[model samples]
Target chain A: MIKPELLVTPTSVENVEEVIDAGADAVMIGEERYGLRLAGEFDRTAVHEAVKLAHERGVKVYVAMNALFHNDTLPELPDYLAFLDKIGADAVVFGDPAVLMNAKQYAPKVELHWNTETTATNWYTANYWGRKGSARAVLARELNMDSVIEIKENAEVAIEVQVHGMTCMFQSKRTLVGNYMEFQGKDLGVEGRSKDRTLVLHDPERDVKYPIWEDWNGTHIMSPKDMCIIDELDELIDAEIDSFKIDGVLKDGAYIRDMTGLYRQAIDQYAAKPEEYIEEKEAWRDRALALQPDNRELDTGFFFKETVY
Target chain B: MRTEVKETAAADKRVITKKPELLAPAGNLEKLKIAVHYGADAVFIGGRDFGLRSNADNFSIQEMEEAVEFADRYGAEIYVTTNIFAHNENMEGLDVYLREIEAAGVRGIIVADPMIIETCKRVAPTLEVHLSTQQSLSNWQAVQFWKDEGLDRVVLAREVGMNEMLEMKRNVDIEIETFIHGAMCISYSGRCTLSNHMTARDSNRGGCCQSCRWDYFLYEDREDANAESGNALFAEEDAPFAMSPKDLNLVQSIPKLVDAGIDSLKVEGRMKSIHYVATVVSVYRKVIDAYCADPDNFTIDPEWLKELEKCANRPTAPAFFENTPGYEEQMFRNHKQKTPFDFSGLVLDYDADTGMVTLQQRNHFRPGDTVEFFGPEIERFSMTVGTIWDDEGNEIDAARHPLQVVTFKTDQPVYVHNMMRKEL
Candidate 1:
């Protein structure tokens, strides 16, 4: 049998059960106001239910409290963390250090998964976080496979790598798209921003076209092409990466099932016939490619190339 | 919903007595000394290795020691920036480098990476650690996180607005610094990879060609078609400064910043000329000192504004401190942002014998043209150029050649790197 190891952000209650059903070893949940995913809809009841469902199925549930907290919100986090701990979350994934600092003080039970929002690129950072009570490190999306292997070799903290989905090219706290819309006199909630009217920009010098949008969190200028590395699951497993992450909290259940199922199948097949992985790699790539949304372009980003200055 | 941050209780009563530090950027040793003379309380600079701003004439061990000595005379501090996110390979020589910086008497090390922060704590525990804005700590909770991590100071992110800053001061028990002036990053604090994807240069590591400021065209590649080709149908299109934020100018926001109890107000131009450093620092220095002297009477001055306007080359906006800037704040994309004055020359040496100044031409200047000469401590002073001549005493109508040292007749004598500019 294939060694089971796949993690996905279940986004909502609508997909939480389905995500677990589709062979995910773990599922991440987030509240709209708390995590980096501003479009998230989970509240206290929803989050409690998600953790219960995942735990019942013998699946680990990690709740994301990954958004950077301002002074005002920092005070509110302790109660939320206590709630997560009360609901029995297996891990709490967060990017901000303040959450960890406060969690250590007020709500100490929730296992902290430090996600530095692409800042933890090296082995030393992994080792550093491991020392600081981080149960896992969701490595930055920018790192190549070589770096990931190096991190795994050096770090005692378990590593989680995003194996599939949309990667942010530019993330800014200033609401660029929101400000631009307000300038046009459109009230955000009243106007109901759609993908049809999404602002598409291309830096002619770089010739890179990207989609820019805003939520409560701020503007996210995303790469035009989404990333999919399910075809390379064997490589991650060989490198001893603990978790293969699917980055789709913003996507729907159909997306959730399709993406999660593809990675599950890929991992299973690769494990069943370790020597046959190379021979069957093309078929795996073809199957994974078919599962992707036809409208969106796809690429194997930053995986093949090292980020050298 | 991310609601607008509310103004907190006025912290004026608690903050007005003790003066906040006026921090300036020193790209070179000369600029470091000039900045302190013009009233910079501290200077942040790059080292020969590991520091960001690879293009700057970063300090060697000797220059850093000399710089520390110079700043000590004025009771100013020197901070070395090793803000680059280090990889495993990059960790070599890091311990040696930290020890070297500490031995050179650097007051602090501004860092973003936890590994580097750990290294600093391990090797140079004596040196203070200031979190670089590159880490993008917009929230006070994040500031507290750095504090717990043993960092002494936290540089607030540019995305942090005025109200948020006040709240940070009220809540976080750490020295808070904010960038008051200079180029704002299009990306969050400094996390970007546009340069990396476009060119081979990784922005996080330092070789930022400022790909955001490149001439661009607004091309709309609609989703309905062009799936394969990625061709765009045109609108009224032009792309210039598409990603360039108008340079931040908070000179007028001195009172609010003072009230917020911000520990330091940083000026952000490391690759700028000594004249730019002198002009910008002195103006901020005057503004900060005026506020400290008479808190209630401190009003934004038109003269100070005029002096600042002549130095900066880009269009200025009160960036995120007030609110998010609109479309008008963006400089033109097809060309560079227009300035009222161009950098005309640099004052080299003054000759009492000839009553003339030897100047190096940066742009171009002619005889009989009025030019403004300003230094670190001095305000704008205009002098009419009588005659211009090259090295061999041959009089030339115009000093056109770049980096050509020429003698020009002047009534007022000036020091080295004192900028002279002609009004356009």
Candidate 2:
């Protein structure tokens, strides 16, 4: 069986190299103008360079063009896809059907990873996109372990699952933060809109703080807890899952490398000797906990817990 | 490159020259009839399973057949929503249900998941498959993608603007449906899982808890030392942070939309009252007709906005239609809507000779309360609540019980399903 590839969302081209060195099998990079909620973006030249750098080490690179495009931005997508194809991007992660359509027209060689964020919940939908030429389906983070296993068992395409990251709970096209600041008769400068500002929404009733930020796309409210599945990697590896994705969009370059390294080590150990990996999970959890941000908490997030109405 | 695709498509389909269908939501059979009576060209209903509005009183298969039969009488169409992003468990009995709705004469099925779409195409080939707005389709290529996949129509996302719709109409050959009036999702419709994370209710699978409307305090995530220092942004003294958006109202833009030849104009809210369905459907019906009948001299009526405001549960703005909504389009202090009008009663019967109209009381009403009566065909008229009579013909001063049969004298002739509202 093929070992599950570790996919890391890189914070920069240099970070892409750092993660590859730390044992990431693949890295995802994008430009802020096209991608949604990226940690950092690369220019056209940087993206070209990143692909070349990753390919040198036999690491694959996926470009994110997952924004919900309006007609105004859509005409430019074919050119963008052609550019990604020309630069030999291994795949293009997409949430909108238009991205797949444009890629089919202009970038047929580049693979398609259907990541609608929350809609790819079942195997039938995954296979449906697969038949339409998508090479992989990123199942929704809302699914539990049972659902994920079921999808992977029945899916015709490759499956990628989020193993560790901050999950986005809410995304809007309206500038909600800007709208609120304007309502309060205050000015929210560029600094206020930056994701590095450590903005969070506190639900006083629940006593939880959710990280919130605004970008060119709109407002994004993240979950209060990040997801860590180091201990759970065995079930996925045993299931022969195609890929494990680590979202470094909200973390630093060091966090990305360390998390990637820990997961890489665990995956290898679990794939090689399941009993030995099981004995080492407690220490793995502690190591992961130590790397978590001071204001953020970590949990297993919808993987073990069945979501109920 | 884009214009070349447009020219080739324009030569084949003159989609924009036709009259747009006015679609409305119906939670049950009663609301379905009310929507059709109020002049909806098409009505979308939900069955007992697979629809997003599970909390609503969705229809059974028998009720769906009856709804289709009833809608057909008025030359209107019935579309069923099987639009849930299906989990594996939800996939059971989906094929059977799609075939049943098709056999019951449903004109189409609005679907979000490809499982449902593929199932409908395989088992119920006669039914038109519409891609739901839950897919958040905002561009022509997405429309073209679904069109090639054998779907008939695509409901554009609430975030799409007028120019985008026009561009889609010019470029794509499939029918385009746009939301004109309704509560807008703060997040893109299907992309949000705030409810799933916050309350353990899956938003994509018909279990939305509306966590976006819940109260939350805003703050910056500073270090533990500074966390308690109150670095809250976008908050007044004690107001809860509100993410609930203003409802979409496109009454003023009816002429532009009709002129643009958009295929269907939809109103969102299956869980709303029959009175809301009647009022909103009728207002849009009138506006669309008035504009289409004489496009050169069409003007928006101020009374239409007043009628819509009477039933709206939130402040209304032209969200993503004329412009990108901003401060005036959101409610930041409180998420709740405040309106003075209460839907007081529904007309059951009208007798011209005795000057008596029977009403099933919906809200509390007593003698001397000023009330307004309106219906699908009835123009708005105000009257003072006079002497009331119970079903037993005994004299009564008030109709205190809910849905209790009450009779009142009205010199003006009223019809069935006419509604009565009183200002509070």
Q: CA lDDT of B412 in candidate 2? A: 80
lDDT digits (tens) for residues B273-346 of candidate 2: 99899999989988887766556567778898898989977888888986778878877666776666999999
lDDT string for model 1 (B1-33, tens) is 121222323655322456689999999998898
Residue A120 error, candidate 2, Å = 0.9
**Runs of candidate 2 exceeding 4 Å displacement:** B1-17, B225-227, B234-238
Question: Candidate 2's residue-wise lDDT over A1-309, tens digit each?
Answer: 469999999899889988998999998889877887786788889899999999999999999888888878887898999999999999999988888888988998999999888888999999999998899999889899999999999999999999999888888988876676677767677437668887777887678888888887788988888899998888888788899999987789999999999999988888788899999999889989998877777899899988864
TM-score of chain A of each: 0.91, 0.98
TM-scores across all candidates? 0.90, 0.96
Clashing pairs in 2: none
lDDT of 2: 0.86
- In model 2 chain B, the worst 10-residue window by lDDT is B1-10
CAPRI classification of candidate 1: acceptable
lDDT of 1 by residue, A97-168 (tens): 888887787668879998865577788888787787888888877778888789888888888888787776
Listed for each candidate, the true contacts retained, as a fraction, are: 0.50, 0.86
> Where is the poorest 10-residue window by lDDT in model 2 chain A?
A185-194
